[model samples]
Target chain A: MPRASLSPGAVVGLALRIVDEEGPDALTLSAVAGRAGVATPSLYKHVRGLAELRGLVSGRVLAELTEIAAEAVLGRSGDDALRALMDGWRSYAARHPHRYSVLVQAPLPETAEAGDRLVGVMLAALRAYGLEGSAAIHAVRCLRAVTHGFAVLEAEGAFRLAEDLDESYALLAHMVVSGLRTAREMSAADSTPGR
Target chain B: MPRASLSPGAVVGLALRIVDEEGPDALTLSAVAGRAGVATPSLYKHVRGLAELRGLVSGRVLAELTEIAAEAVLGRSGDDALRALMDGWRSYAARHPHRYSVLVQAPLPETAEAGDRLVGVMLAALRAYGLEGSAAIHAVRCLRAVTHGFAVLEAEGAFRLAEDLDESYALLAHMVVSGLRTAREMSAADSTPGR
Candidate 1:
């Protein structure tokens, strides 16, 4: 039996590359084995099955996203942190569109702790902007909706506009920033207005 | 020849039913034909192929969504209209999660006139709130993102809240209405905000 230098991480990484190059439908266990220069059984030895492999890829992608998001918010606060983190998110989506989709759809319980950590990072970042409780939760969800929708649409070429999409995204980021600012102000005013 | 009463629309409708009951991964041409009480070849007589069948399902879903959205905005204006329409969007999503997802991810033609019609319908609804041009476009996109994201996450059980999701959804709609109003007011003042 010939031993391959490839690890499970390498196999999953190559699988992601295949997905990125050929779309998710093109991802097959045999194909991943071939790409990773391993026997099909050898591939399964490390990963459980296609679903498990997909889960691994999803977890890795989510962890990467969480790290990038955390880095983006580090040393930044308020609206600036939100912008930075959101930009990090958009950039991650842009750079890894297929993997991003995988992350979006794949349910990785293993990544739940990591995802929660990422959310904590987001909540902390928004805390600088003064949104807490339901407002904070609402802000995070709204941002996720806006960012996920835009990224997925962009990936699918849904922006059939004559104008550049980048411009629209920039404007979107601005509006989101301003909206968060308003929400923060309102949150403060709830305590004491006209001070 | 054994003939069944299944038509193309019935086939697609049954396929949507299968999707709703068993999920997209469970949807297959054979399964659709089986559910429609027809032969596979007879099913093909009504549709082009699997992709076409999926496209038909997506088209019907989008058409229904357009009608519901139009109805939600009727005789309503401003925040009232926005909330009603967005609520309608969410209801559509919740009721038809599988088809809604297919609608989001399916590839439409670059010059897909159907999508244009859908967008036009949404824009008309926004116009009830006095939005025009790119603001109208942006509002539609934002609304779509929020609706799609929330629906997707909701269907996927992404939210881990102890409270009722309907409560969160109401808050979501309220927040979107607020944001849209702010965007409308700000865009109006800018006088030359570009898409």
Candidate 2:
């Protein structure tokens, strides 16, 4: 693991590993360098500092999440797509709780391109329900709020009940799908002629 | 401000103020003591240390949130109670973003009476929908996830679009109410004799 052998992507990959294994609090330049078998200074050659390293990690994770979500919803739409997307998100968070925590805590990249791409996938899924612009954004935010919130709470072991989480999650997904449909119907009713 | 005069409640209150003003990261025991005009070591008489102080703060805040939510839904039922409870939660989070952050980050106390009370308030509100048992827990979890997630994301400036957030929130509330009704209807249908 010579400095010449270490690329920016390699450094970030190691940093992601650190976060995944030891939690976000353990992700420091020294820790990453130690794990990667490179000098701390050599790590700086790839990332300016911890802030930039965190940004890179966040961006990378967001992109990966976007890809997973996109693949889940491929050739699917409406409730099917929503369920697939949400289940994918929950699975990703469960598998990499620390990395997911980083995504929630770290600010999106300055350009926000990665975030936008993630949102784009969501908007595309919402298209099945004929929502766009602000309506779709509202629905997307609602969906994100519930799924992200549930995943974070679950990671924190906040749900103390004895019931199976998978069953609980299914029920949550049902509510979201039902809720989106209801919102669409309301919007349609508001646009129609008076009775 | 003297150690002899400082009560545990007073120390916890001052700690809350520190969290509210400067974010949870700044909530050191020394910071709380300095703000209260007491010596750091003397503050320990009131709180064991940072961990206990955080637990006390979390328990206190959760109790406060439960009170606010309970009051909001008093004499209300169904959609009215749901709307009031969610709005109350949103407002509390908005007014004290850092404190809300601590609520999310800090682990609930071992006794968890405060946390259970909060859930009790949620269940009472859902009673209007004729939901009980696991269904009610699932619904309560759904409500918590969406409202908590929305508040956290909003505090992080994740909602960057120009749309009126109040309007979006209103739409979300509408969706949740409608969804709950729909779920109720579906549950009733499944239990009926007809196909």
Candidate 3:
């Protein structure tokens, strides 16, 4: 209980392991304290409370995802860039199902920067489609939903059939890209001077 | 303690209420027992245990979803049928956010009939696209992921932007249908007698 060197980073690292292994519900001050070899109250000096811990964890999770997206899309453009970013996203989700599972929840205030950066990467790749305003945003949501939805379903064993998931994922990327490819024309068509 | 007439149906009804009002995690035997005005042990006489209760709940959820999809797609075909089914899915998820949250998990054996019917409805809608075998299965997964992903994200407040979600959903349907309309060609292309 006397480990004075336990910084917030150390606390977050332990908490991440807890989240990665047992899921978000298992995270608690007592749980982290037990892992950190300290009393639950003693840990308050390092982090504010459970919410703060979760925020820190969220920040880390989003930041990591942003990095993966950036790396995957680097030197790529158009469908290739978008596909790479999505592939990185699903791979991250698959590797860390527990962490990936929490992503559906809105990021906390502390994690907004990381969250925005992640969105920025997605937007950068989506730039290839020339969609603007609402169309671009909708495309973002569609891509996110596809990857997030597919990854979560696969992790939960929802796809019970014997079909190859990898193949399905590739097909999804193709479909979404096709959808993105049309957003511009759809927008332009909507903007035309017609009744 | 002499309520020997309490049927399994009664227990499931109570469990469904708990899940609807609370969530999947809140469906413990003790909680259901509290709602049923009986001891946890007495409730066990009707339902086997927590797992069985979950299975029963899953069956109810899937059955209800199957019914919605069937009604939505009735007398419709191709994109209309597909849109109705997807709209039905997202609306059902929005209405029963708590119950919908658990659909990602594998359906317990008891829920297989309901689950299969749900898949059947989806397949029926997709029949107009003329996709079969792996291509058909992949298309199904794509649709499932879009609705599931969008619903879950929306429920969790993940879509923080100011864009209209309804419009985004419509766009998603359009994009996915466009992708599906080509699945037949994509499949045929794969089977062509070329190296």
Stretches of candidate 2 off by over 4 Å are A1-4, A38-42, A108-111, A184-195, B1-4, B108-111, B184-195
Q: Largest DockQ belongs to which candidate?
A: 3
Chain A TM-score vs. truth, each candidate: 0.86, 0.89, 0.88
Clashing pairs in 2: none
- The parts of candidate 3 lying over 4 Å away from their true place are A21-31, A48-52, A104-114, A184-195, B3-5, B22-30, B104-113, B184-195
Model 1 chain B: ten consecutive residues of lowest lDDT: B104-113
Candidate 2 residue B145 Cα shift, in angstroms, is 1.1
Cα miss at B52, model 3 (Å)? Answer: 3.9
Task: Write one digit per residue (lDDT tens) for candidate 1, span A78-163.
Answer: 76788798788888888878878776667547667767877787788778666556767877776767677777776666777775
Could you tell which candidate, 1 or 3, scores higher by lDDT? Answer: 3
1 against 2, candidate with superior lDDT: 2
True contacts kept of 3: 0.71
Itemize residue pairs with steric clashes in candidate 1.
Answer: none
- Residues B32-75 of candidate 3 have per-residue lDDT tens digits of 88987888899877888888888887888888888999999999
Candidate 3 lDDT by residue in tens digits, A65-104: 8899999999999988988988998899888988876654
Better of 2 and 3 by TM-score: 2
